[model samples]
Target: MTVVKFLRLPENVDLPLPSYATPGAAGMDLRACLPDGDVILDPGCIALVPTGFAVEIPSGTEMQIRPRSGLAVRHGLMIPNSPGTVDEDYRGSVKVALLNAGKEPFTIGHGDRIAQAVIAPILKPQIVEVDTLSETERGSGGFGSTGVKE
Candidate 1:
């Protein structure tokens, strides 16, 4: 397990820190740190909600911002840039860009659980120049190349 250090900003001093919902949970819940009462996200609109904290992530790893399953299923809320990556060297406040796909508007209140963040290691692949590629039965087939039904 990797340990990440988080610094809470002035606006978030009274808010709860991000934490895993359960013992088996892989991601930690992130909350909205809106200083105002609430913000309304109209249908088909997107808003960047601040988490009011910056993190010190270990090198070779990234923090992935994700949407909560309950919000997506019940309110049509989604993270526009799903799995948004926060590089290890970044020191800016973490924020979540939430998009409302439902027909009605969604209200985001201060300290509301808006998203979840997961820390994962990143892999850097070596790039090599190739003249020709190997042949295969399904070489270059994509976008439903295989049969839809079995």
Candidate 2:
């Protein structure tokens, strides 16, 4: 197997923590910095918390903002927009939008690890607008049209 690595740094006023990523992996520690490192979100609720940093990602690449699998499965907690796209051109502080789908509130305290981010390559395409487009096998089929039963 091959490995890909890219250098990243926290922008001004943003501190980068020691990453504990294993071989061939990229990881960064995120702190909640809220009460007890927990931010409580009620059912059907949403909360946006700073990631305590900003980044200068290189062009032709992107960062995926995904929720911790453990948090999602165990607490019904997740990023409202799973796999949130962080465009390399964006220079603002990164924030996570968390929502609670469970029946109770979930708390995120200060220094509590909230989400995990993965950096990956991105492809840039030139715009070519057309009046018509090609169709697919299931053209315009609505959701669930694929099938409900096996």
What are the Cα lDDT values of the candidates? Answer: 0.94, 0.70
For model 2 the TM-score comes to 0.73
RMSD of 2: 4.4
Give the alpha carbon lDDT tens digit for every residue of 1-150 in model 2: 323233333322333452545676465545553532456688889999776666667677787888877788998888888888778878776778888987888877666677877778887689898998899999989889889888
lDDT of 2: 0.70
TM-score of each: 0.94, 0.73
Model 1: per-residue lDDT, tens digit, 76-131?
99999998999999999999999999889999999999999999999999999999
Q: For every model in order, what is the number of clashing pairs?
A: 0, 11
Q: In model 2, how large is the Cα lDDT of residue 24?
A: 61
